[model samples]
Target: MKITKLQPTVVAVPYRSEEVWAFGRRRGQISVLLEVSTDEGLVGIAEAAAYPSVDIVLAVLDSIEPLVLGADPFEIERLIRRIDLVGTWHHVRATNPAIAAVEMACWDIVGKACGQPLVNLFGGRFRDEVECFYYVARADPDEVAAEGRRAAEHGFRTCYLKVGAGDPRTDLDRLAALRDGAGEHIGIRVDANEAWAPGTAVQLIKEMQRYGLELVEQPTSGRNLAELAYVRSRVDTPILANESSWTRYDQLSVIRAGAADVLSVDNQMDGGLLNLKRSAGLCEAAGLPVVKHSLGELGVALAAAVHVIASTPNFRYANQAYGANLADDVTLGYGGGIESYSDGCVAVPTEPGIGVQLDADRVERYAELYRAEGAAFAFHDDQPRGEQAPALPKR
Candidate 1:
């Protein structure tokens, strides 16, 4: 069917609990949802990442509407290339997320038309359920350790903790506490968010080995491939590269340098599901296991990830599906609204076209939240001095 319209809207949803990271504290997430409607009355849905800002995502989506409005939803790659061509080279970095969301909607439409799940389009299903990890945003050692225990109580096998928030001692104490609290059975992985120097990462990681870290992700700046390689060589724990790579060229550089032992892949980062599959294929060919990244996404994005990871053969690490941490969700009727976590894993969506239907009432409610409170909302770096640091909440 021919494309009919591209609709974009903002929604603000509260977090189930407050989270603190190196950046700051926040209690909710804001995301832009895009719906692509076809001539035959089918609508495809997707959500874009709005981390640093949501305005950027909206502007990109609005600017690219012309490129997507009249195209065939099934000719996904052609539509993507057209959007890229019109927007120019720099546009890829700036607007690929918007394009990625639109592409996902197209895939949803395609899946519905074919009467198949998105997993089938991603090279068939590899497993019925995909494993996930509980995320504890950067916090004090005791708080993080407590969350780790809760993760195990909730049946998670792995706990993902944010690191590099403060001094070396911060991470050391946090890791030690998490290991003790989570017990010996739970696996712990830490993400530094490119906050450390190679030297610092090396020294700290060497010490963290005692706690049995599953991996240390993106310890150094993503651009410093040589440094990543050096850290990987010096450390016994596997190094996972997240911010360092996205496109094929970036992957090529990382592969050539032997930068990291594993690569973290995200649908939005790679542009769309097809690109994600291609990126995973590259990692698979290189014999590196792939891990999924989370940006505190909601159900739409989380469902998309689950379908992709479930179909991927080398997705060894637990997929980062942090939507479960959200206090409420806007979509429903897709395996408990994509927050169906139990025994450390979530079942893949079996229904056609990503298998999620929007809860109209919730959407309107959150959209109202966006309209009324969007301007007042700002991320950690955006807040002024005096109001910058908020106390982390205790469970």
Candidate 2:
């Protein structure tokens, strides 16, 4: 079927918990959604990772529409290539979140046309359900510990805490409390979000070893593979490369440098599902485990990630998509949808074409919120708040 229409809508939804990032903190997220419809009456839906620039991403959707308007939806590679050729520079870095979104819609259409689940297109499922971790978003150590215990009580096998955003000593203490609450059974993974220097990361990660860290992620900046390698050498914990390895080429560079113990990639950063698969393939060839990084996605993107992760044999780290933790989602009808966190894993969507149906009403509700309030109004991560302020003591 020939592709017919491309629709873009921006939505702002509330977060279930306070989210702390290296750059900011927030209680909700603003995301862009795309609906790709074909002449045969089939529509594929997807979400793009657009933070801080919903309007820019909306404009990007308009610009890239011509490249795939009348093309074959099933010709995923050709369509992506044509879109890239039209404006190669636009696809660089996380700026291509829209490109990835459109590509995902194309895949959904192809899967629906073939009457198969999207994972089957990627090489079929490797596991029945995709395992994930509970990501603690609060800045308080007490809250962090409580969340860790709650996650374990809910059956999660791992807990992820964002570190390096504030005081190093306090972050360390928070991690220690998380370990204590989670006990020895739950795996603890910390993401520094490239907020630390090599020496600082080495010192911090070394101290964190006492609590039994399963992994430490992107302690230094993404550009410093050598520094990441240095941190990796000095610490006993496995180092996961997130910001440093966005694409397969980046993965190759980090792998060659012996910079990381694991690779973390996301569809938004790497371009699309195929590129994410290629990134995982590179890690597999190098005898390294590949991890999926969530870009605060809603159902569409999270479902796509589950499909890719299920089909990827090298994927071993806990899958995450904070949308699952969102108080409400703009979509519905997927087997488990986005709020399906249970038994420590998410059941893969079994329906055709991303296996999720989008709700036009809910989409409009959030879209109105986006229009009236503006994207920035929905962003609360710009500054420290509540327990995040006054910088608490360590130990």
Candidate 3:
């Protein structure tokens, strides 16, 4: 069937707490929900993280409408290639989320047409459910400890916290508190988001290891693989690559450099779900484990990634998700809040396509929220400290 129309809605879903990171903070998740309607009456659903900005994602959708309209939904690879080569988006990494949303919608359409779930089409279920970590927003030591206890109490296997946003002493205190509160069993993963320097990373990781780190993510800048390798060599804590492995090409370089023990992959960052699967395969061949990364997504996008992760092996670690932070979701009941998770795992949907349908009322509510106060939800911090640029490696 031919594609007919593209309906895009911007939504802002509030977070339970502010998401504090190395660069800035956000109070919620802003996503562009896309619905691709086919001429044959099939409608495929997808969501795009408003990465970089919402305007950029919206502009990308508008620009690719001509290339996507009238195209066959089943021809995902060809369609994506056309969008990349013909639309001249091959070099623009920022345009990926929008392109990925289109590809995800097409996969949804294909799954529906074939009367199969996306996991089956991708390679059947290598796993029945996908595990995700609880994201503990960066906060005071007490708050961090409380969140850690909450994650453990909820039966989560891992708790992810953002580090490198403040002084090394403060980060150390938070880690100690988290470990003390979460207990010895719950694995703690820390992401620095490329905020540290080689020396600082090594020193800090060595100190943090006292609390038993599960993984140290992008402790140093992603631009220099050598720096990552140096820090990795010095620290006993395994380094998980984030910005260094945004695309398959970057992943290969990271592999060649022997920079990391684990690689972080994101479909929105790379362009599509198929590419995400390819990323896993590539890392699997390299004898490296892959963790699905997120730019903050809603149920639609979260469910799409879950299908792929369920079908693929080598996703040995708990993947990233925003369930612990999202206060609500636009989808009926698939993937928002800790309540949606059962022991930190989300079961793959058996229904055809992505398997989760939007709740029109909730969608409208969030859509209006986006229209009214979307800017506040963006990846920016309103705090005065956020206005002053942080010097990298913050020694």
Candidate 4:
């Protein structure tokens, strides 16, 4: 059936705690939810992380409206190629989340039309459920320990914490606390977000290894694969590539450079769900495991990724999710808080399409929230702008 209309809604869902990273902090998740209505009366829904900014994502949707309005929902590949080549968005990685949302909606449409779940259509279920790590957003040593205990008590296999946002001593203390509270069984993954230099990364990782790191993510800058390789060679902790592997092309370069032990992939960062599968396959061929990265998504986007992750075998480790941080979700009951997860895993939905339906009331509530205070939810720092610019490879 032909596509009829695109309905876009911006929503801001509050987080249980602030998501602190190397660059800045956000108190909530801002997403642009898209509903693609078709001529056959089928409506496919998806959400795009308001990466970079909400205006950019909205602008991308507006620019792609003409390209998607009359197109066939089943022609995902051709449609995406048209959006990339014809729309001249092929070179613009920042515009990917919007394009990905549209593509995800199309896949939802395709699954509904075929009377099959997206997992089956993609490659069948290689797994029944996809495991996700509990995100520990706090930085205080006591808070980190408490979050770690909560993660372990919830039966989570992994706990992800953001590092490189402060001094090395502070990060070490937090890591030690997490290890103490989470115990020895639960794996601890730390993401630096490209904040450390090669020497600092090696030295810091060596010190942090005492706590038993499961993975050290993007210790050095992503722009230089050699730097990543150097740090990886020096540290016993396996390096997980984030910014270095945003796209399939970047992933290939990472593989060639032998920069990381594991590669992180994101559909929103790349283009679509199909490309997510392709990324897994590419990494699988290279004998590398893939972890699904997040740009801070809601249930709609989380569900879409779950279908692909379940259908793919290369997702060996627990993937990233905001469930531990999200206070509430717009969707009925899919993914919101730690309660949504059973043993740190979300089961694949058996219903046709993406399987999760948006709760109109909650959606409206969050939409209103976005309209009222969306700017505060964006990727921003508490520090005043221009006062102190964050330099890379912080020494």
Candidate 5:
């Protein structure tokens, strides 16, 4: 069916509490959502990783809307390539905000058309439901230790904690207690958010080696791929490439350089399903692991990730998207695990597409807001070529 319309929605949610990761703190959440309607009367929904520039996502939808207006919705990859070929330097960063949104929605349409869940289309299910894990967002040592016990009691097999802030001694004390609390029942994973240096990462990894920790994500600066390799060679903890958000090429560089043992799959970063599959395939063949990364997605993106994690066989880590169960009422698809964590894994969704339908009321309410403001309210650098549309015709 030909694409009939492409609409973008931006929603802002106030945080219950501030989350302090390696990159400062965030108090609010914003998402770029796309709704694409096909001539055959099918509507697909997708989300992009556009927390940095929600408006840019609106602009992207506006520019690409025309490109897809008369095109077949089934040709997702071709449309993406066209965007890139016609895109400017900034367009890669700018337009890609909506790429994952449309790609995922198209996948939803394809799944609905085939009467199968998206994962089933990939390769069928390997596991029933994926096991899950939990983490205390930004807990200090004592706090994390307490939280770790709660997570263990709740039935999570693993607990992830934020590291790479403050003194190394403090982080060590927190990890030590968390390990003690978890004992042998739960795995402990630390995310430094690229907060550590080469020497410090090596030293800390050596110390934590005794705890049976699962992996360390972005221990050293992610800016320099070589530094990651340097630390990887010196440390025992497996490294994950969380910062490789741009494209498959970026992750490929990390893998070829021996900088990472796992790839954190962020579909929005790579633009959508096509890139996600490319990265997943590369990671699978390279003997590297693929892990899912979440960008405060509400329902759609998380559901899409679940299908992806389920279909793939080379997954070494559980999904970070499992954090959705804790994000207040930001969504309606709860029931993951508040007491007993994700059964210690994520499972395949048997439903079509992402399997989680959007709350129509919520979509309508948000869409009204979209119509009024539109993304063209603010301006940013646009992509090259005829990649983008003129800015709202100067109001």
Candidate 6:
């Protein structure tokens, strides 16, 4: 097989509204897409899950170019794991996604070449559709209620609300409104996004406990690990680790500390497929539930995540996936609803090679929007570097 260097392209898709978190908030997210090419006119593509910097996405892809440029397209795992000799943990986060980009691309190539679907490579399918959840954060208590009502009306039995980062009074008020709007039929899940402290979290969660909510994600602040564990001990509600659970060892830490009852792992942010696989295996071994977390990724990684979620039998909690209310066209022909539901459960997709394809023209249009949104151009003239300190002495 022939190898062609991959390149980074930026795309921006509009959110119907925005999903607020501990980090400021935004109405739209920038997407970075990497396209891999091989001989016999086949193509594979993957997208990084985070947008902290689109350049990081490109830098990652560029860094792995040398390792994958001349390799066979079918030796996916061997090449991905072999590159670990450079640095497993560090490079896994930095360069592995770019490598996953290539791996995903190669899967597409080989799947098409052999007329086999991607799940065949993964050993076969266990799921046909992935269940989904919808996020609701209007900041207005009434609006929050309205959003909850809409979710329920749309047949979404679960509501993922954004709390914490706002005023405490607002959080409580909105929680009340949300409960009322969803009534007793809907599952209520709150994501604090790590906006509160241990003590306040205990108090607030205790109040939220009265509602018999589903789970609280990162209720306490993320900075203090000890306090996180303490908050877990204090609350009766199940604690789902968001900010704190990033690795296999992290899964162990959460279990050992008795901090989290469930784990929400973002495959892209924690790293790509390699780390996600490792983390999933770890969670399975530990007998803990897993919730798929996505950073507003489009079809590629989103569909990849569906495959992973389906493959893992122990990931019983609802996965934080896209209802896919946003994509004009998806990798697969299917679209995720605003949230996943049937009897109020998400369904995993069964398609070949992640089951989604990017529209080149649409992606290009978003790339232009991303450039306009300023992924590479920044002008910040007034940020402190550090306090004045003595210079280092020459060796």
Clashing residue pairs in candidate 2, if any?
Answer: 25-381
Off by over 4 Å in 1: 89-95, 333-339, 375-377, 381-395
The candidate with the higher TM-score, 1 or 3, is 3
| lDDT per residue (tens digit) for residues 1-395 in model 5 | 88888876666443444555654555434566677888899888777756457666677677767666877767877877776776552354433657678778888888887778988877776556665557565656676677777777666777777776556776778788888777686888888877776778888889877888798888876678888899889887788888743467777788778888887877877777666767789888888878777666655676776677677777656667534234332345532235323555544557777676666676566555445553532223334658655321111
Off by over 4 Å in 2: 90-95, 333-339, 376-395
Q: Residue 295 CA error for candidate 2 (Å)?
A: 1.2
Please rank every candidate by TM-score, starting with the best.
Answer: 4, 3, 1, 2, 6, 5
Query: Each prediction's Cα lDDT score?
Result: 0.80, 0.80, 0.92, 0.92, 0.68, 0.66
Model 1 C-alpha lDDT versus the unseen true structure:
0.80
TM-score of each: 0.93, 0.92, 0.98, 0.98, 0.84, 0.86
Q: What lDDT tens digits, residue by residue, belong to model 4 across residues 145-196? A: 9999999999999999889965788888889999999999999999999999
The TM-score measured for candidate 1 stands at 0.93
Residue-by-residue lDDT tens digits, candidate 1, 131-239:
9888776667788778778887888888888777556787778888888888999889988777787888888889888888898888888888998999999999999
Which one wins by lDDT: 1 or 3?
3
Candidate 6 local lDDT, 228-283, one digit each (tens): 88988888888889777755556667777767888877666554554676687787
- Model 3 residue runs over 4 Å out of place are 93-95, 382-387
Which has the better TM-score: candidate 3, or candidate 6?
Answer: 3
Candidate 6: residue 87 lDDT (0-100): 33
